[model samples]
Target: MRENDGKSIIIRRSRGWIPINWRDLYEYRELLYFLTWRDLKVKYKQTLLGAAWAVLQPLFMMFMFTIFFGRMAKVPSDGVPYPIFSYSGLILWTYFAGALSMSSNSLVGGSHLISKIYFPRLLMPTASTLAGLVDYLIALGVMVFLMIWYHFPPSPGLLVLPLVVFCGFLAATGVGLWLSAMNVEYRDIRFVIPFLIQLWLFATPVIYPVTMLPEKYRWLLALNPMSGVIEAHRACILGHKPIDWISLEISFAIILLIFITGLYYFKRMEKTFADVI
Candidate 1:
């Protein structure tokens, strides 16, 4: 209970199937900012390379992928240079993967805070995903450098890059909500997250183009939301072809489904977090 003036406010656990209290979240917006900033500080603290690890992680992966997938396997990049092609996709993938991983573990990692505090539990994972944007922006600098070296000029499609990125963020946040809530109950979730990320990386089109698959099989890849996000990034940044509206529409629907369902699930699980954790 908190005291305001001479009055006391009573805090009660939410009843069954309640919708998210957007007002409550808004009221606690400063807490969200604090958590996000704390995550950023904690992420880079005591690291020898500090923020440079963000650039080097994706950059080195791009090099290996360029050699193995681009050179050895002769992967098609829609005529864009393989390095920039792979790097562009990698930057977003790196962000999504990091966001998903961090958020999945957020609740368990913050167990002490969860047990002691009255803040919105959703803020934990939300801040985890939001903090990754710093790393995302840092990695994008390497992409810009690669684009310049490869002589690939930005296209008008760049206008929609933010939307594509939001889609990726939505996917990460949605999955994080589901996994983080479950992780509170099942400790094994932490073990599964790394394997899940590895599989999801291959499922996404980070190292190859969707066109590499036959037309009939292309729909399969489109079913994965990250495919559309990555392909749209290539369209916007590489200017290979016009954006694929149909695929993007499908991806948006799936991402929306995941987000809405994840929200309900997280809220349903929220009441039990303190007890379970």
Candidate 2:
């Protein structure tokens, strides 16, 4: 409270779902920075492998998929080699899996701050999601090496790689917000996230080409947002096929719907966090 001419003035946060205080986010930007940095440090603090885990996680998965799916099952990669094909998909998939896992647990993990302070609860999940970008960049470097080793040259479509990554970010952040808010009250969401990620991976064409499915059934893939994002990544990075705009549009629509609803749900639930936590 500030005293002015013997009167006190009070400021309050707008509680409505649509009216967010953007100024508050801007003011707390430094706190977001600290939270992101802290998350990165804490994630690798005691690990013997440290940051190498980022590269190893996806790289090892690529090897396993290449051996089983590429060699045994003879999974088609739309003419792209199996190892690079799977590794490219794994780069984005790993980031999304990590982002979704960390962000969903962020609120419960930071319960101490929630009970003791008045900062935007959204920052907890946002920081958690952003911190995984460090791992994404590291894994992406390995992808570059694979592309060179395989003598694959990127097409002009490669320029759209950022858009594909952003779509994945939106999908992860949307699901993260919903799960984190619900996890604050229920606490069971933590267990469900791993299962959800595993199911989602098979639903997406990460290990195989979407073309293996009949064209009549291909429409169902559009319902899965990562399907378009991962497919777009292959088209851009591998340059074997044109980007699937129709599927991508549908995916974007679904992602936007999820993101907006998640924001509203998160805001609605945050009011109870300090007390419940």
Candidate 3:
């Protein structure tokens, strides 16, 4: 606790809202990598299919959608093959859903770590979210295969894929932080997550094209952050022309708002996690 020349070894705590310290996170960056790797290992460890499960989930979902939505419901696919069209959205959606599921439970799931050590709790959800990238890549490979099978050539629009993926990550991580923080006190939150995901799935444009929606009601779809991500994915991956910037802008604005508010909520509640969780 000794201080000399206006320097202190320990930064004193304050009652005021704690904003994220990028320096602290950077200093502990190695830990973030470690946690992320740990998640990857634990996820696939002792599994029959191992990492293939990543590809399978989305691949199988794409199959079902190709049958049900493409054939039975006659959903429009923006001129791309229904399988590839749905696969594009499924890949991104699966990653978002998986990350959200894992991250929303990460804090309580790792109760032992929180009780035993001192580190940024924020890193837990972040690690859980990022760990799903492995799954995303595996599923993306499936999408590539589908594209090749369907003779869908690659497009220059693929350049924006990274931005679309970033939006998905932001949206997932933001919601994950909020849920994980709340799950500490409300165990029932875990029960509701599945239903919430199902509802969110229908709300996003994964199974259908955004053009199917009337112009006036497009605003409602834009409110979902993944709407833009999924829409951009379909356009870029399927070589569809002209992304909907309006949707992307709306999604981006919402994600920023969610991320900032979620971070604040997580920080304000994190101090109590160790005790309650």
Using all chains and alpha carbons, the TM-scores for the candidates as numbered come to 0.95, 0.94, 0.95
Which 10-residue window in model 2 sums to the lowest lDDT?
1-10
Ranking by lDDT: 2, 1, 3
Tell me each candidate's RMSD, in Å, in order.
2.4, 2.6, 1.9
Error of 1 at 69 (Å): 1.0
Model 1 C-alpha lDDT per residue in residues 142-261, reported as the tens digit of each score: 778887888888889989988998998998999999999999999999999999999989998889887788888887887798888888877887887999988888888999999999
Cα lDDT computed for each candidate against the true fold: 0.90, 0.90, 0.89
Off by over 4 Å in 1: 1-13
How far is 271's C-alpha from truth in model 3 (Å)? Answer: 0.9
Per-residue lDDT of model 3, residues 116-200, tens digit only: 8988899999999999988898888877777788787889888988888888899999999999999998999899899999999
* TM-score winner between candidates 2 and 3: 3
Order of candidate numbers by TM-score, starting with the best: 3, 1, 2
Which pairs of residues collide in candidate 2? Answer: none
Candidate 2 wrong stretches, greater than 4 Å: 1-18
